[model samples]
Target: MRILIVEDNALLAQGLSAMLEALGNEVLGVAGDAESFVTAVLADRPDVAVVDVRLPPSFTDEGVRAALHARELLPGLPVLVLSQYVEDTYARELIADGTGVGYLLKDRVARVDDFLDALHRVAAGGTALDPEVVRQLLATRSDPLTRLSRLSRLTEREREVLALMAQGYGNVEIADRLVVTERAVHKHVGNIFLKLDLPPEDSGDRRVLAVLTHLGAPRRTARDGRDGRG
Candidate 1:
């Protein structure tokens, strides 16, 4: 894939460009500031772009601003924003785009293979977020998370199953990921719908929304590996 690198830190940007290049992809242009970031993306229209969470000038959310702008400028262009921290609002804003997007901590980049895998997946139209980031999101006092907590209480396995579902895994995909049977995945998903009190018409796309909303701010109902339920 031809990709752009939008990051303010010079050394980090150079390092990321080198690594991405080693993976057999072109790094079209590396921009160290917000204006240049936007310009490079609009000019090149690469397959995917890796952006920092913060950029020049403010360095607070310039990358976030660039990502939002790319949504309008490039439309379907896939983007992966790496950050040093999981700012709740930043995650919320990125997730709003719904697909072909990834928000992960900079630390995850150290896991080179997984990081590249995430890039490839996102470029191929997938959602990618760190597990701990998801965990942190679900732990907040958001309305959706609260409801998911109530929904989570209804079953033993459903809560465990919900995360994989939100991560864009299908029955077979989730089965392999969780080391479970396909039939078991189906049964757990069915129970999830019933327990969550989904609408009668909730199937397919609607089901995806339910899981997304639930996981968007999912509340954890377990302590460690133990379920909260008796």
Candidate 2:
């Protein structure tokens, strides 16, 4: 796969570039700032782009903004953003559109295999959100009562399954984590969609939408009293 790196830290950028190349993937180029990152992206059109959440000058959310702009220029372009901290706002913005995107903590890169897996997942138009990011998003609520009311429809187990799904874990991985059968995880996922009133669609899209629904500040509604299986 051909990849592009957008990190302001020269050492980190070189390290990432070397890692990608060592894995037999082509490294198009490394851009240290937002402008250069967008330029490289529009010009090379690489298979995937690995970006840092912060960039030159402000070192704030320049990378996030640049990434959004690049996607605007090249719709559906796969992008995997690496961040040092859990910036819930930026993470939500990246996954707002769903597929072909990922937001992982910079620490995960030390886990070479897992990091590569996330990169490939994003490259294949799949989501790869960090579990820490999901946890932070779930916990960052202004109104505890409203948040509880909105999620009151879901059973404890179903909520657990949904959180794992938001973290980009598949049924098998979720099952492994929860020490349950894969079928049980699938059933929980289905129930989550049903209780959330998400329409029937591709399972991947439903997974993302379910996460968005959980993260978004929607009004509380009446709850269905049905018990979830598994």
Q: Which candidate is the best by lDDT?
A: 2
* Model 1: lowest-lDDT 10 consecutive positions: 221-230
lDDT by residue (175-210, candidate 1, tens digit) is 888798989988888877776665433243235445
Angstrom error at residue 185, model 1: 1.8
For candidate 2, lDDT tens digit of each residue in 110-200?
9998899899989988888888987777777666676667668899999888787876778888899999999998888878777767654
Candidate 2 stretches with Cα past 4 Å from truth are 200-202, 217-230
The true-versus-predicted C-alpha distance at residue 126 of model 1, in Å, is 1.0
Report lDDT (CA) for all predictions.
0.73, 0.81
Cα-lDDT of candidate 2: 0.81
Per-prediction CA RMSD (Å): 8.2, 6.8
The 10-residue segment with the lowest total lDDT in model 2: 221-230
Count: clashes, candidate 1: 0
How many steric clashes between backbone atoms does each model show?
0, 0
